[model samples]
Target: MLLDHGERILTASEAIFRGTGTKLSGKVAGIHWHYGTRSHAPELTAGYYNTRFRDGYLPIASMFARHGVIFNFTCIEMKDWEQPGDAQCSPEKLIKQVILATRKAGVPLAGENALPRFDQDAHNQIIRNANLRLPEDSGNTTVEPMCAFTYLRMSQHLFHPENWRLFVSFVRKLAQGQATSNSWEQEHRDTDKFVHAGGPMVQEAAALLH
Candidate 1:
């Protein structure tokens, strides 16, 4: 959810949790640089970080804790500062800013991916390790799996009625508790009654769109 210095966001989140009958698993709080771009001024960035933590983050965190919601806070680095109209700053500096603020606020840090070239396996490991140590060092560690997609593409064929039919049928079967097997092939058969490597998976995704 978007961070705001208002009570409405908290109340609305609670309402949604109750209404859906879905258990609240975890919360991912994201902090972004001002105006969607990195700030070059050190003092400005520091002030913004301190103010946001005190006014925006802390109270909401308290509310969630009162409601028994486990969460982790994260920051999004604007890696595209190399592009036009963006303020350029080092990824290391941006990361430091976030960690320091969350540390002071006594909130657990959430794992995040930013900075294009720094998303490699080694860098990811560093993030995971740091999060794991949070509980030991600060006694505040509630990290959740953060899924980052580097590649995703949508096929136009999914809009076709024929394609959507097969996809929907597969999902319907699953919703009816048909796919009990753990194996992919067996589950697909139980869900869709067919499995073809050429692209049954793609078709199944389209079918559910209807």
Candidate 2:
């Protein structure tokens, strides 16, 4: 069913472009998939992974690539489970699977946060994922960085004084370059301390400058 939906979208897009006499060469079209991890019992993880990827994403991936559809995925900020017992279906593992699939299909990739978050940790995770810095992808130059990244949603909380400050810093870091894991950790620590020490008034005043 999902595959059929994807095909219909591609077909409709082609038709629209043809009817409007618009060339599709430079046009961008994408399909967004929400990343999901099965954290069930370890015994069931393999089956779930195969069903979700092999049957679900893998088949549609090639189809999308053939139509020049970008694979824009979400939930990039999820962390891996530390417990060995729960490692089979960790977010890291699931995200890696998606990355490999997209790379194999020769599709351009993009990402989005799963939720609206203003913390440095979440932003750093998004940066790492977007840069394809996963341990397995390290030194693998063939893997490309995300073509783009979208923050999940805009909400009242996002505009709060402290949140706004952190958000500005996050944007700056992203623009700078690909950050190493150590740099992300240091930034997380510094941001935590700063947020704790800053008062509401100070944060509001600081936000006004940016």
* Highest-scoring model, TM-score: 2
lDDT of 1 by residue, 1-210 (tens): 233432466566677777666544234434343333333334244333334223344454455455545344333323435434543333443444444544444444444433332222333333333433333245545432222222112345543544534444433432343323357665445434433433566656666754
Q: Write the per-residue lDDT of candidate 2 for residues 66-119, one digit (tens) a residue.
A: 777677776687675422443343566556766777777888777777667888
- Candidate 1 has its poorest 10 consecutive residues by lDDT at 144-153
The TM-scores of all predictions, comma-separated, are 0.36, 0.64
Judging by lDDT against the true structure, name the best candidate.
2
Error of 1 at 39 (Å): 9.8
lDDT of 2: 0.62
Give me the displacement of residue 115 in model 2, in angstroms.
1.4
In each prediction, how many residue pairs overlap at the backbone (N, C-alpha, C within less than 3 A)?
4, 0
Total residue pair clashes for candidate 1: 4
